[model samples]
Target chain A: MANGIIEKVKEQATSVWEKVHGSQVAESILRPGSPFKKGYSDTPRNRSYVIMNNVLYHLHPVKVKRHGVRLSYTLCLGGISFFLFILLTITGIFLMFYYAPTAEAAYSDVAALSTSVAFGSLVRNMHRWGAHFMVLSVFLHMSRVFYHGAYKPPREFNWVVGVILLLLTLLLSFTGYLLPWDQLALWAVTVGTNMAGFVPVFGGQVKFLLLGSVEVTADTILRWYVLHVLFFPFIIVIFMAVHFWRVRKDGGISGPL
Target chain B: MSDIPEHLLRRSAEAKAKALGIPVEDVLAEMTGEAAPTPMDIGEQPKVETVVAPDPATPAAVPVAEPETPSQEPTPPAPVMAASSADAGDVDYDAAATKAGMPASLLKRSVEAKAKASGASPASVLAEMLGEEVPAAPPAASAPPPAEPAPVEEITESVAEVVEIPIVEPAAAASVAAEPPAASRSGGATAVAARPLAQPEAVPEGVRTQRLLTVVKANAIQQVKSEPTDKVNTWPHLMIMEFAALLAVTAVLIVLSVILQAPLLESANFNATPNPSKAPWYFLGLQELLSYFDPQIAGVTVPTIIGLVGFMAIPYVDRNPSTKPSDRKFAIFMYTFFMMGAATLTIFGVLFRGPGFNFTYPWADGIFFDDLKDWVNF
Candidate 1:
């Protein structure tokens, strides 16, 4: 049978891997209980140990309900959204090196980065597209949860947490939108902050807090740059820790009930 | 157009008072004589009678029919049968009712009334309804026994039962095909048995509705599963999916970034505003709203308040315990409508607005990409 051949090939391949990776360094790094090392036997117990022992793998549980993993149900949207966020963070950090967030320098810096710096456009593009993707994937993730009724009961608090995360993602994108400081960035932010000025009692105060002036300026660019680079990302990291922790505590992604 | 039977009203009042943590005497004292004739005020009384009565005509017996009841009478009795079968016998009906979703007060009155009317002991009636045993009905009902004494152990057992229900249901999580047969509760045992297990003929080609019973059973047998019985490990399952997503996203973005460069149209000049200056795509939804309302409501008040209220109200408003989408049609529909409205508004703002902010389709001139028209022309 094809399965028998596959099993034989897998056995051979694993033994070969073990032989190649069986040095003293490998052994030190991958002890019997190490997440990097698989146990002698390919049993469920060992597989579980593989997940539980590793610092990175420990985030997930040893056993998973089959329903929770169904691709049709989840569409892996939340995972994709999280992945996109990570990608954005990495690319955004690189973009920050070349970007100068000031009224005079912002536009020229972006133009130079794209035209002169090697792979600078590529990095910028990845960050830009990743932001857009995270927004979309987060929205789709919310929709998936809604459609699946995964937001019901015990998981209700997590759903609210997810909504807050979604808002944070939007804010992240909106703040970053102005860092380019071109005609598009300037006008788009002008229209956006104008909306904040419509808030009732403390509208003007909030607008001042955001723009640091009656209009978008050097100060506004600097404020948005700090938020996009540091302040918002820090808040997001804290919220994400809670969000994933709650997902685990609230019984792991709410299978069919 | 008659008053609720004085005895039935008294029992319902006592049950409600108990549920509300109020004294029964205070509840009874509060009701005036003429209030009884207004069946509208005593709506809870008829619901209790309906649950208790095995017959569909039970509401008529409660004397609160008000000539508008017969049409809607059949609906409640079916659930009574389901309530008994789903959590019958040694399982406390009151506790099971709460779990199987016959609320405490409603099931308490129903179980008591049904037992009294049948002249059989409550436990025996419950057992009989479960199709386990058929206790003979007593000939006479001249004297009824007082309610059973509740021991400490029994109270604790019921509490445990209530706590355990939620955990058990998700573990016994049936497949889509298995659900319909179980959920069609009114369709008796024979009917359920007659239905094919995984009706291949019913399912469309290329789609298999196979039950994951083997996986569930394997998980059930193991004390220490490699992963949580109810969850998949994130490393391989989730990590792989996310990695694939990242690759696909990066590839697409690469192609896009290579083909079309990001726009950088000169420096910001305060004197020169783009004719149809607009917000980003995400805030385009709000910009669209501004067209219909005053800036305060559309931009600040409505958006802020609606987001807060909508997110917070989900748990409180939707008390439906089931998570199956089929069971939650209205919730799905309303959410879909809200999302679709936002999408429509964003699309309108992003693609339709032109110079002077007037309506213009994507094909029209004076749009964002109008300057690139010569290069883009096919």
Candidate 2:
């Protein structure tokens, strides 16, 4: 009886919807077709459906055959790296709230974040270590994917994205270096950015822009700060989206050997 | 019709329509056509007209309209199952069929075939054989089907339509989930199902235990992903990417530390300052221009503007993978070399050696700013 009432209500609601929005909505709601196909659950929509439906689902293979080393393969290293990147982003933002880019007090801000604020030291260390770990994991992820032949065929562009991400990781580190504004920070940035001076035609201009004029000073520190904290991160995120989208488009990672 | 059960007989006309995969009216129209030819042969197209019911005083008459539905050729049903049944079951079939190599159809066929071959009714054979244990076997499922041939088509179609759990060919996309350093292949569908599946891998005695251990072992392993092997192209391969990276990072720290020993002093306290009070080496390029423009403009304003633009533009300039270092080696190399030279020149001018004022080597300093007037502009 309840089902009958609900069915009647559904019929009425459908007609009402059709009246308001036309029959397309009604047709779509009642289409007789399967939403998915075989061998292609790696599509972005399906992946998210799986992830949101079952969080641990991504951790396991679609088919689990009993092999000698099945467990080792099921928990991917890339997933770990992706998780750590998330950790770093969170901690980095927290640290940012306390850090100032000016040479006058950037060092003290770090020192205070380490010793003064509540759990500040832990947050800073975690951010610092998270950065380190993410770099390591991402590197390991690339190697694992390569050895497994995952970078073949459809996954090629994602490899390129990974490489770009690697560069961005290094850049993030380099930009953060100057936030401390100590002699060590200044010289380190100087040496790092100096590598840019090798460009053929626009080398000098690139150098001037990075240094803010001719050298590492307050301007350079501020530049590195914004780039590290804001610019590079924003860019890296966009690239990451494309990378993941490509992974889905390319039919997921290469399967077993 | 009299022998059929009431529920079976009452199978709704709606159910019949659904099962036949045709509209109720269409079936009626077809039956009518066969029973008595229509004056117009019902024309080609069946026009789908919506029925608008008026008040109870008058009933709307049902009428069949003709409309041309595109002709769809009958396609054979694919032999396959839904990837994972979100439908129903508590099937012990897999366990029963494991040793038998049997498909389900064959299980249904066994008694029938045995009865026919032995000249006994299938029910009579089952009644007499009830007490004897017929080990649930799979091979028997396939044995009886070949001679009949009809079931082969059914199995073939099911095989095509079966929705596999692993959407990607299992062998094709397994590594996506392989926790780095270990490739645990728990065949069948998942680790959860592998417990039962592992029983067969034990044909080699301890093989089952080992497979279980491998699947269990992946839990504890430290899965470090983002391996840099393929990225060896970005960095020189000779250093062994990781080692080179480690070395490069260490070199960077060392080089920076060495350069910091003689950091340029801030111009804010320059009166009693040492001979060269330049900005940091990283700031040298800007300091070189301070010699020309006012401190407010060259020292603060210009650098500020450039820094804002540089950072803000990064996402726009290198938004995609096509601009990666591996794809644009020369561009990366140039980016590196040019930035480095400029940094060095700027540092050298501000702290150690300048075009004017102080007299020190940029590396060791006595350097101070010299005017274009005080020294050669070039």
Which candidate number has the best TM-score?
Answer: 1
C-alpha TM-scores of all predictions: 0.59, 0.36
Two-chain DockQ for each candidate model: 0.36, 0.02
Score each candidate by Cα lDDT.
0.64, 0.46
Mind giving the per-residue lDDT tens digits that candidate 2 earns over B268-300?
221233333343333556656556676556655
| Model 1 quality (TM-score) | 0.59
lDDT, candidate 1, B85-126, per-residue tens: 433445476654654465767766766776686554565444
C-alpha DockQ for predicted model 2: 0.02
Model 1 residue runs over 4 Å out of place are A1-20, A31-41, B1-239, B369-378
Ten residues in a row with the worst lDDT in model 1 chain B? B43-52
Point out the worst 10-residue segment of candidate 2 chain A by lDDT.
A60-69
lDDT of 1 by residue, A1-257 (tens): 99999999999999989876776778878746444554456555666666676665535766666677766768888878877888888888888889888888888889888889999887876777678778999999988887778877788888888888988999999999888887888898999999999988999999999998988888999999999999999999888888888887887777665
